[model samples]
Target: MAFNGKFELESQENFEELMKSLGLSDEVIEKYKDQGKIIEIAQNGNTFQARYNYGSKVITNDLPFGQESEFVSFTGHRVKALAKLEGENKLVITMEGLTAAMELSGDKMIETLTNGVSTVKKIWKRI
Candidate 1:
């Protein structure tokens, strides 16, 4: 259950809706939908760091299990998040009004995000 790899987005469901619900501007959503994003993650023991890159812009987060820390949302908002490992390959994160889970199975990574109002699914492939 090693979470050290570069992942590229393969498909997204309700991405625009989720971005809009998260207060992202229409222009930003349009650009994101067209370009997509890449994520690189590294995990060491109980510590995790993830880098998200979209063209020239990049965001990084370092998360420790079960601890509250500041993390940047997709919309660039600094939010509080608590992350914990579920079993071997699933990483569950809870933020203010939102919950996200990322699971690595075989060669794919499946991520789900929910914020009460809407749910978004993002599928990624290892690179």
Candidate 2:
């Protein structure tokens, strides 16, 4: 779905570079990059999931029985990971941390929460 990489050597430049590679119009990428949330995604697919901080606030997660749905929308779902807001950390899920979190909310979320240390390991492997 997505290749794991960081454009952090130069946040703005690297963001521009990665966005260009992702086929975004220069105008589109510039909007978000200007705000400094470089790695955010507006959409996703079945094989992949994405995470972004919302308003730098936290939310409680809830779940339903077998909470499966054809569409998992989070517009009103303002929950975000503590570190995501700082942008000092980036999470690129290789296995299923991203997968599990998207599936189960509430207490099951951390099981899907990206492993910060493990993620750094994966990033190191790619670099």
Reference-based lDDT, each prediction: 0.86, 0.28
Most lDDT-accurate candidate? 1
Candidate 1 clashing pairs, residues 3+ apart or interchain: none
Alpha carbon deviation, residue 7, candidate 2 (Å): 17
**Residue 114's C-alpha lDDT in candidate 1?**
88
* TM-score of predicted structure 1: 0.90
Q: Compared with the true structure, what per-residue lDDT tens digits does model 2 show for residues 1-127?
A: 1222311111212445544554558777655454423222222222222333334532223222232323222223222221111122222222212222222122121122233322111111111
Candidate 2 residue pairs in backbone clash: none
Q: With candidate 1 superimposed using the best TM-score fit, by how many Å does residue 33's alpha carbon deviate from the native? A: 2.8
Model 1 CA deviation exceeding 4 Å by range:
none
lDDT of 1: 0.86
Give the count of colliding residue pairs in each prediction.
0, 0
- Give lDDT: candidate 2, residue 87: 22
